[model samples]
Target: MWELRHRGAAARPGGEAASPPREGEAAGGDHETESTSDKETDIDDRYGDLDSRTDSDIPEIPPSLDRTPEILKKALSGLSSRWKNWWIRGILTLTMISLFFLIIYMGSFMLMLLVLSIQVKCFHEIITIGYRVYHSYDLPWFRTLSWYFLLCVNYFFYGETVADYFATFVQREEQLQFLIRYHRFISFALYLAGFCMFVLSLVKKHYRLQFYMFAWTHVTLLITVTQSHLVIQNLFEGMIWFLVPISSVICNDITAYIFGFFFGRTPLIKLSPKKTWEGFIGGFFSTVIFGFIAAYVLSKYQYFVCPVEYRSDVNSFVTECEPSELFQLQSYSLPPFLKAVLRRETVSMYPFQIHSIALSTFASLIGPFGGFFASGFKRAFKIKDFANTIPGHGGIMDRFDCQYLMATFVHVYITSFIRGPNPSKVLQQLLVLQPEQQLNIYKTLKTHLTEKGILQPTLKV
Candidate 1:
């Protein structure tokens, strides 16, 4: 070690000196004093006490890796150059941005797969971290199973399916039949998958067995986001579905981080110690602006870039779908290629789901809560970033936490409020019912509505 640097010193410097070198002493006699430089070199090369050993027999030297200052060091040593730090961070940011846009460009319907991927990875990190902080334990295989199952049957209670299956169900003569028929298999599948996950978690012994079961909520949230995205994708153009939520949520996240970095002063929540109240409020409002921007853009070009995926217009041909219809749907876990060809002609497509603007906004306002919630959980466990996978950014959980909850909320909202607008009675009244049947039903409703002609947008029959 330290001895390696001297190269033995013909090379030996500091030996013993009497007074000064005696007259006629070997020229090397003074070498021992010169040995201070050798000692310095040894200290530099082998991480020794050179700062203290100024007179030691070692060569003068540069600082070693351990001696390089930290971020605040201010000095620029080859051992800790700012350029290397900046270069690494820049490359990492570039990589994440590239990935973000790659998913963006892949049409929305298709990107459900990506959403699913993020959900699984992000949730896996969250759940595993809980175990790490609580018991310093690693639960590997069970976590993998949780992710796999979460991805597989997420749409059980949801009626998600390939585009065409969903389209054909809605476009056919029977509307009520469409919903009832699809839910039969899906409901069972949903419960069955849930049961399986429950059993698996118990049998495999993921840490905090009961809590692991509770973590199913994470799985549920993940599923919900996937289904929500599918609906939005189907209702609007695939692009908007991808663009709206992603732009709103991720943009807000970035904005918050940036604002917090520069302008943050007041603390928002103890859960997020570094989170600034200013940043939070700034981010929340900024998200609304982004939502408006998204809506405006999607609504503007929807006609050209997006064609309707479906419509209630009863035409056999496809038209763009609405958010309500798209979100409530639960499709089979059919592979894309198979489903694509099978559902091609039968399904509808849309230029954009303008209704999603409302839905996306709902997702936005509620979105910050998702981040807050995850932050709370992390702080409760006293864990830092989920992992160091992303250089400047935190782990997948850090990135997608908001989207998971926001997407779930939006999906649920669309299913209830936006999609199920009881248009079927209105549709039936306007269609080819038998004259007698039509007359009877019309007569019954006519008196009521006629009395209440206040309904300016009267039934069209």
Candidate 2:
């Protein structure tokens, strides 16, 4: 009879005992089968015994609306969220408006201080970001060098402004006179010192990052300090230069948001996905119209139209000028549609308003590109906004990005078209010259005038 052996095989014909056949013997396949079955059992146990489950045991997820329209969803999305924070936004807006008027009432000096403050804040924000990125590498003197460069740049720019606008006052102060006299040389030496320090502090592996940050600091200074200086230049030209272009941008932003929220359909630019073509077009038209009206109203006030001239006699600022032709009303032929509607031959408008069209056109069309540039910079850096300084308004940089560009345009416009030589400034320079130098300039001027045929009649020794 044949029998299954548990631990040993039957003895061979020689009657010798067979070993236990190395434990598994004839049951090796069965042991492996049991092990696989145990593993399956363990898996089922861990998974809550799936073999015993039924269709009814599965829970159903609630049905959701898969067919919701994107436009409707977008419109609906912000309504609830914005209303939830409406109080904060409202308070912020009121505060901003109040602060804006307060600055206006405070005059050009305060406005200048505000511009400087904002410039410093912007510089701080950008430099801080660079520091955070590069400081981890323990690069030596990176932050110090950045701030040093800022100081050097500000010293140069502000020194020039002081010397230009407050020449009499600066010449009175011995230290100020010295600084003003050698301002460029002083600025260059300071910057060179910082540059040498940067080179000396460079580490073996951090040279590339160090140079990158060096370039970054200079660029930031150019964008923030230089542009802010231009804004101050606008301030000096007149508060209107500061106020109107800024108002245009603010108006465009408000109207654009309102238009976009209600009727924005097509995307305007990929850099700013939320920007829409409808809003852009609406804002442009609205800004142009607003610029014309603001120009009209402001033209009527010497306070708005005249330059901010410092009165050393009274130690105060003054704005007193006969309205220039630029601010005077001129007759404009009405377009056919307007003539038909109004039954008038012409309309009276300030001549500067024509220039406003250019300003407004820039504020509407090209100005937003500044914001777009800022948006790209932020995206590249993976930042949401420059900072959270102004509550709902992101940061000072965020608010002033387009203003800087507008400032540049206004400055260029004034220099190119509106500016004329100031007799007071010319006389100040003449008074500062040596006696011989002054006499030479007079003789040169007299000779040149004598050469002109028109001046020959009036020529006298």
Candidate 3:
């Protein structure tokens, strides 16, 4: 009977011999099996549970929708993968640039719409990545709450924009006036609702993963919506402020690619293996020169140099103002070495042209770090791109990673060195105040101006 029992135990699934216990010890076979199972479950939970698939399960080249033109496909049928990609990228770059010019011609409202669209697409791409990484698509209210938060954030930001730039228009509409008045509170309430929903949706074993995705949604919002908001703010400053910086970044990207494609030998960084020192240096010079010329051309145009403003009289936005000194050409004496090169002692250029140098320099040097950061993020997730939205460029987010960074820099630069207190914006704020408060401000300003002898002391009558 003992030999038969030993043979049956040895034939068990784990293939380990389960010998009968000796007299001094308790039979612990079942306990040992349970303990071993527990250890394996713990290991699985620690390392493999969060992701739905292991590394081997992920494909090396992410599937992308082929968007190549039919003609191009036939024309380049025999090209190698490398040269094929180069042509596709180059062609798409020019197409996007042409579309950009078309949008610029469409005016500021269209530009605002473009920014909003890009923001939504970028948010979607990032949130999609989060869902895939955590396998959280099954989580209740995940997509709903993510989109709800986006709506709330956009409401808050665009509300502030309306209150600032369209105060007159808002004041004319009773419903809008109320909404603008309670905008922040309403925004907070909307967000609080989403937060409560998220808390309610938490599952027993999914608490940690749910929190991870929750944080992921917020970070994605911060990157996409916030930076795009700044881009709009820069747009309102003037199209020149918007266009010059953006064009400089584009110019840098193109020049760098061309230089690198032809002459790249030494690698620039490991995060982006293809980036080259030759590209960096070549791009910097090209971008600076391009910015200078573009700024000069754009600064001369009132439509490009003037701040966008809502005109209640026309019930439309307008760009009409005396060009700021930054846009006006000023003469500067060249350095001794430059005098000989130019054959002139003095050169006249828009002050904004000088500022473009700083903008282009940042776009060339620091803006690329944004792309590198995106590259590292993709590597972490083992993703080749954020999405296959754009055939050759990866996605809208891929093209715009550096643009968002540039937008933030332009906003900061304008605030730090360019912008000052605006009388128009101040008046807009005052217009929304109560009559009594407006009267008080009027009296205070009158008294101050009278004391300064700027306003003829009105006769006591």
Q: Write the per-residue lDDT of candidate 1 for residues 1-461, one digit (tens) a residue.
A: 22432444433335422344457867665665456646644533443222233323323222112322255234324535535444444456567778867765554434556665665566566655544442322333445555555544454423544322344444444764455456557566765776576666442223344454356546554444464545454334335544676667876776676577678999977777878977777777777777766655554443323423433455332324343333332333546786787864333322234455565555546777777787776555455566555644567777766766655555565466544433533453344445688688877786777778744555578
| lDDT string, candidate 3, 1-461, tens digits | 44645554555446555555556654466456545645544543454444454556644544557777789888888999889999989888888989999999999999999999999999999998877655533666888899999999999999999888998789889999899989999999999999999999875445676787899899999999999999999999988889999999999999999999999998999999999999999999999999989998999899999999888989877999998888888999999999999899999999998899999999999999999999998887788788887667888999899999999999999999999988888888898889999999999999999999999998876
- Measured against the true structure, the TM-scores of the candidates, in listed sequence, are 0.51, 0.78, 0.86
Q: Candidate 3 — which residues are off by over 4 angstroms?
A: 1-62
Total backbone collisions, model 3? 0
After superposition, candidate 1 runs with Cα above 4 Å error? 1-99, 130-152, 155-159, 162-242, 303-366, 412-461
What local lDDT does model 3 show for residue 378?
A: 88
Please give, for residues 1-461, the per-residue lDDT of candidate 2 as tens digits.
01333221222223333333356545766565445644544443444333344535433322222333355456456577655334445556677878989998888788888888989999988887667544544557877888888888889998888777777676567898888889999999999999899888865434565677789988999899999999988888877788889899988877886687678999999998989999999999999999988888888899988888777668877888886788888999999999999999899999988988888989999999989999998776666667767655666788788888888999999999988987766776676667899999988888788788546656358
Q: Return the top candidate by lDDT.
A: 3
Candidate 2 vs 3: which has more lDDT: 3
Model 1 root mean square deviation, Cα atoms: 23.2
Top-TM-score candidate index: 3
Worst 10 residues of 1 by lDDT: 60-69
Ranking by TM-score: 3, 2, 1
